[model samples]
Target: MTSDQYIIQRKVNIVELGATLGNISDACRKLGVSRQHYYDIKQALIEDGIEGLLEKSRRSPRIGNRVAPEIEQRVLDYALEFPTHGQTRVANELKRKGVILSAGGIRSIWLRHSIEKKSLRLKRLERWAAENTNVLTEAQVQALETAKEEKEAHGEIETHHPGFLLGQDTYYVGYIKGVGKIYQQTGIDTFSNVGFAKLYNDKTALTAADFLNDKVLPFFDGFGLSLLRTLTDRGTEYCGKPENHPYQLFMHLNDIEHTKTKVRHPQTNGCTEKLNQTIQEEFYAVSFRKTLYTSLEQLQTDLDAFMDRYNRERTNQGRHCRGRTPMETFIDGIELYQKLVHKGELMH
Candidate 1:
């Protein structure tokens, strides 16, 4: 029984003992309670029944800064639409719509729902997409496939060092009137959050191999590190027979192992998905409106500059980066990579 029930039962025993003894003083002394305490308990029971015996809590009943239900609902609804967004970004976007909640307040709401982390919020969005796929927009559908918390608390995330596993993906960066249909090939080191991207007019095995040959390998080579394994979704550009397919052939030539995500679950390569979203929101969305691009090279040039800054300047809050730039994390991890390589434990 609960403590309250035990307390009430003991008080009732005191009352019964007094009757059996026919001496209030003797019964009170045996039970270690004063007669006055006994009378108070009896009176409380008579007046309000057993519920009166429950101990009163010392803390306040409600949180002082809890937002109203309607306000909390707005934050939750916004999370569904923008699962990749952090608390500050979420608050800023909400403020644009005239809602005046602070980032801390929005975070408090997220904590209550177990979605304070981007992965947790994405996990929730993943569930929503499963149940409402028919009505989801293009972006929402992408978000669903983009990230899932591989947490034991929620999903399982493997700890990796630099050059361990790089996640790669292709994103259709919307259509431009004069530039034709644009696509981006993206890569991210799962350990350090270091990212790379290149834009092209076509999605093909040629571009996929070119991304690794040109952008990815050179950077790692500069650091004396080797690119080990790559993770990607099952796109035609990534998966094919090693005999003639340019992308598969490239992997075979480089001695790099290839890994593919589950058939429909793109979130397994969440690092690249996250990088794609970052470039989409922080770069392309703003750039497309500010200038008129006449050729693919113009957009590609701007994309390269932004990615340089992202690697060297943008501080990340990921588990490994922890407020440092991706380049910093990448540099720090090189020592660990070398140690593992020397021990002959770096192989898949």
Candidate 2:
């Protein structure tokens, strides 16, 4: 039973015990309640029935600190209009319109309405716009259109085969005891989950180009697979005017298509970003204190060994290669494609 129901039942039992015992003091002593309290319960039951025995809310009716309905509606409207904005930004926008609210208060409102996440809020707004286009203001209609366009522009990339798309990025591995700050150039095939990494003392265009040429290109070439495209962030190491950047020039010379991610979206190169994180957690973090390396050459050798084990033995739980190691997934995909080609079921 609920606490309120239990409390009411106990009060009724105490009253009943008083009536049966024929002594108020005895009943009060047995029930551990004062005689006056028993009388109060009896009077409440007589006046208002069972509900009178239940506990009532202790909170005041006039909650002065609560947000006004109109202000709350304004907050909701502002959030729907710019679903990508954070709570602070939304609150600031509301304040500019003379609707002052703390960021926490705005977030609380968002939480109550289940619109805290940008994606959910956008979906809600889009649904509302679609259902009530005749009633929406011009500005609201325009905002909905803009949100749709933004969502379309940032859609996920789809890769059909192992060598179709590769993501490359650089990571700064911290300084070692004997070595200065080291950087790692990492690349990963998005479809196969196969990864390549090389450590460098610096993050230069030349280093990036050399890593692609020596490590990544050679490995794929050994498998008789051609890397069609490379994706990287718009960092100076990977992108610039085609005539000036070493990395861009290298891709051009090798007949590989070079694609740079949108200005602020590092997630476009998420595969290599994840590879950098894995190397840091699995290799660098574990090996830094366990092994002593007096030179960069020694560290590079260890890194290469770790990469070999990672590609051959570590089972990738990625969607494309659920239970297979990277090398296994790569080879299997290539063989499948070749078989389809030989049977005249797939085009070149």
lDDT (0 to 1) per candidate: 0.79, 0.75
User: How far does residue 67 in candidate 2 sit from its true spot (Å)?
Assistant: 57
Question: What lDDT is reached at residue 142 by model 2?
Answer: 38
RMSD (Å) per prediction:
10.5, 19.6
- lDDT per residue, candidate 1, 1-348, as tens digits? 977889888888988899899998999999898999888877888988888766668576366567888889999998876666678767766775788988898898999899998768766865675576534344434433343322211122465689888889888876655667778899998889899998888999999999999999998899888898998888899988889999999999998999998876666776677778788755654454334567889988999988997888766767898767789999899889888889988856
TM-score each candidate: 0.58, 0.53
lDDT of 2 by residue, 1-348 (tens): 988879988999999899999998999999788989998999999999999998767675546777998988988887655565567666655665688899899998899799988767766765665576534444333322332111112234667677778888887766554566677888988888888988899998999999988888888888877787888887789877889888888988988888888877766766676677667545653444234556788889989988997898766767778757788899888986677658866422
lDDT of 2 at 255: 85
Model 1, 42: alpha-carbon shift in Å? 45
Residue 288 in model 2: lDDT: 45
Clashing pairs in 2: none
Q: Name the regions of candidate 1 deviating beyond 4 angstroms.
A: 1-159
